[model samples]
Target: MQSISSQTSKPEWLSSNLLLQPFLWAMSWLDYILAPLQNLIGYKRMAYFFVLPNLLIFGIFILIPMLLNFYYGFTGGDSILLENRPVVGAANFEKIFSCQDFFKPNTCAEDLFWRGAWNTLTFVVFQVAFIILMSLITALALNRDVRGRGFFRAIFFYPVLLSPVVVALIWKWILQYQNGLLNAFLVSLGLTKVPWLLDANWAQFWVIAVSVWAQMGFFTLILLAGLQGIPKEMYEAASMDGANKWRSFWNVTLPLLMPTMTVVLVLALIRAVQVFDQVFVLTNGGPGTATLYIVQYIYRTAFEFRNYGMAAAASLVLAVVLLILTIGQLLFQRRQEAA
Candidate 1:
């Protein structure tokens, strides 16, 4: 018994790790620091104190940058310094909007900007649709009782863990013109080598497809959580009432999942609008600017063209569009809750 117990017990160093002692001692000071503040604020209000650090970080990073961007939009100059920039009023915005025909980008003073805008619109519509549809399908499949279900879930989610740049690079190697795996496979099957990234339409298609493949996993996990939250008893009840599987899913599961679906939809929309990294690494807005998105346009305007004011104006426009979408989502969620 003594030998067995000795074998099962953790080693002394493992049981009380010396490496953690300093960290633990430092963390213990939090009690001294927070106790006085908690007493002054009262226990109920102490929640704010715990949350203060996050609010400070947000203010320092996100909120401040956004306010600065907004200010920079009204100023114009080649200089990056705000003081050197002259207040240009609405000239930057006017430049962006100075198109004769709204439908024709060639009529615009900033034709590239218009092109990027139209490309972004197309990307958002297609990417969001695919992401939502694929995510829901994968979530439903994973929620079922099947062999190796855990492995399948992990396989689907593994792509989400990869960096966007890394994902793009991997796909770039696979889609290369000369020695790409995809091209080789096509040749083996008696098909000619196709220019996946060099062409306009193919580049657009692949960027959207690759983005959908990378991000679908995260939304799938959200949907899976929603699916699991639904009570099994509802299915049982429906079964007793002679309802088919399709009927039970259509009536019960769909309604319960709508809230989660709305959250996923809005998140996907916002993410789709801000897409840049993967597409940048994959296409670099090449093939005659076919895949040049709004974010890329802003980036080039600020850095490449040295047009800080125009970049800031474009940034503000993008922010306004996102804000509208977010507001719409909130209102929809409010109505959903009310009903």
Candidate 2:
């Protein structure tokens, strides 16, 4: 051993250069923190082992990134500056409002963004209303002891289960201008073939309709669960008081299911306003900018135009708007609860 040690100039510390340093240190830290408990209980009694990893993961993946995004939102970011860039307050936001599409001839006649914003709001407003009402009806219908209730539930849920892209593709086929299923069926019934995706008006309508179709299943399922939770005694009591179906729904059912309904409406509104992917696949926000949602515009601004700061700023604005809506919903719900 002396001869072998003398033969090499290598240091003794390098012999145990194991890759387990971090783990060993971590376990040692754990032991030090929990050493007092070892006298009173077992190793499993200390929840640190279970707790530390989850806390570590949450901090690393969620909390840190959320904090950074908030920071980035304020940073006047450029794709060239990449990360941790300097702040240029309010410039990004101003750009979005002031951007004039001067390159496009005849586009001057219309206020592009104001008009696009109008269309987006209309889509969101109508779609959310339709989805909530339709979902409620579907939930009520499926809540009964009718024949093949399970099958009907599955059928409703089926559209929601399909990938958004797949749903979009399916709807596209159905709504195709010439040989589409919809037009073919219309012709068979001695009706005219209609342009579903080619016209601005019709395109807007289908975008909303298909979105409602794809989403209704999931919302229906949610409301159905809420409906089931209402006690049968409530219905019987209402009936004993001579309330009809509509009256019972408006009074007993509505108030009792308000909590779930509140959640459904708020979520649906957020989703509807940020509508993309389905619209992306089905119409790409056009025939014109008829279905061009705010998100798509931001996406194009950021990635397509390499205006990272503007994109980030737009997203922050969208987030703020959504937060405001959510707060409104919460306040309304509180008022409802108080009433």
Candidate 3:
């Protein structure tokens, strides 16, 4: 195939005005500015400039904060903050590991924060797994040929699009003690109020359940797109080999869905680690720090306690952990791809 060359291509105005007017030396500088602008905005990717202002804003707001966070991680004092800092040289890192406040705490003389770590891990593993599975199932169901499919899919994905605060507030109202909608309904049905958010176990359950409800819809939509792109003939071929629905799904569907699953897994992992807003709104790491995630702790450390340096150090450590986990997943994915 003969390819068109992008180089040596001059606009009609430039070719006519510059070439024919050989005596116009003063106008040459005009070409320097106008030529590039014309090429950029004339007809090729001109809309990209619309994002230029956003890009600048993001650089100032997000990028600058990120850079400052990284810089603060290495420094000893809380340079940008005022509290519990006096240039103590890697003392924070040592404290992060050794301190009884987090990663290890002695509430019952048995380490309460370590217990909280287990609680966080349980939430991460079970909540993420349940949400992913539910989402995948919803996606598969929606991808099928059915009546009112669009309506059903939209209903499922609507909760995900809502702001976290709004969703949390809604859940809060529903899951509140005796006056809550959920408890009221249950009590009306001859059941006692369930204390959904007050009890420790109930709080964890509601947090996970609410999180899954919000999360499943979006992942379903994503996985549904991946599912719809798959050729139907592949499933038919597997069926011809006497494969059942389960076998076809496992053998044909799942293997082809690896790329989508990989994306879902990594995104879920990242979100799981950074779970804060829902936990904050729903549990406030409460009933006694039962729902406190690593992020929630960091948030308290930085803003609540004003321990910015330690918080920065914790944030840096988290970034490193997430990076390593992402890289590890990518390596595994590459191996699967190769195989």
Runs with alpha carbons beyond 4 Å of true place in candidate 3: 1-64, 74-85, 99-104, 107-116
Candidate number with the higher lDDT (1 or 2): 1
lDDT of 2 by residue, 109-155 (tens): 32444455567788988999999999999999998889999999999
**Where does the lowest 10-residue lDDT sum fall in candidate 1?**
9-18
Q: What TM-score fits each model?
A: 0.88, 0.77, 0.77
Clashing residue pairs for model 2: none
Q: In lDDT terms, how accurate is model 1?
A: 0.94
| lDDT-best of 2 and 3 | 2
Candidate with the greatest TM-score versus the true structure: 1
lDDT of 2 at 22: 69
lDDT of candidates 1 onward, in order: 0.94, 0.82, 0.79
Q: Report the number of the highest-lDDT candidate.
A: 1
Descending-lDDT candidate ranking: 1, 2, 3
- Per-residue CA lDDT of model 3 for 1-339, tens digit only, reads 135545557678776866758747646976676578868668456566657889999999999988977656655654465344456667666666675455446632324335555676789898889989899888888888899998999899899888778888999998888598988999899999887877888888888999998888888988998998889999999999999999999999998998888888888888887888977877788888778777887788778876677778778878897998799888988998898
